[model samples]
Target: MQFLLDSADRQRLSLDARPDGALTLVFDEATGEQASVAPRTLLWYKLACTLPAKLPPAIVRDYATKTFKPAQAYGALLNTLGPCR
Candidate 1:
C-alpha cells in the first residue's frame, strides 16, 4: 500500500521508503534528520494536511486509529512522491 500526496504544485514534493519494513517518512528533499519521520507518525502528517477538519478532531481522541505501518506495507508511498531515495 503506497500513499501519494497530490497538491496543486507538483514540484515541491518528496519520496520516502521503509526498506526495513518499519514505517518511515522520506522527504523529497533531504532535510537532514528532520525529514525522517516514523511510519505511523507520517500518517498523522498526511491527515493534518488532507483530511477534513472534523476528521482530525475525531482522530485526536484516539491516537491509535488506523495507523499504517511501513513494515506492513513495502515501499508504499514511494511512487506517490515519484522516485525512491
Candidate 2:
C-alpha cells in the first residue's frame, strides 16, 4: 500500500511486509518499528481526502462498521515530512 500526499514535496508512503506476515509502514528505509492499524481507520483516512462530503457506497458496505485486525487484508498509514534544510 502507498499514498502520495498532496504536499509541496509530494511525500510518499510505502507499506511493506514483515517476516511475521504483518504489514509495516516504511519511510526513508527505516525499520524495526510497529506499524499496525485498523483497516477502517486507513480507509476512512483515504475517504476523508477523496470524498469528504459522504462515505463511498462500496467503502461503507465493505469496511465501515468492522472491528477486526484483518491484517492480511489491511495495512497501516505511515506519514513523513520532507527533509529539513
Query: Tens digits of per-residue lDDT for model 1 on 4-34?
Result: 4444676343334455533333445456432
Worst 10 residues of 2 by lDDT: 76-85
- Model 1 misplaced regions, further than 4 Å: 1-11, 23-34, 39-85
Q: TM-score, each model?
A: 0.28, 0.27
lDDT of each: 0.39, 0.39
Q: What lDDT score is found at residue 85 in candidate 2? A: 20
Model 1 CA lDDT for position 64: 35
Best by TM-score: 1
In candidate 2, residue 9 scores what lDDT? Answer: 64
Clashes of each: 5, 0
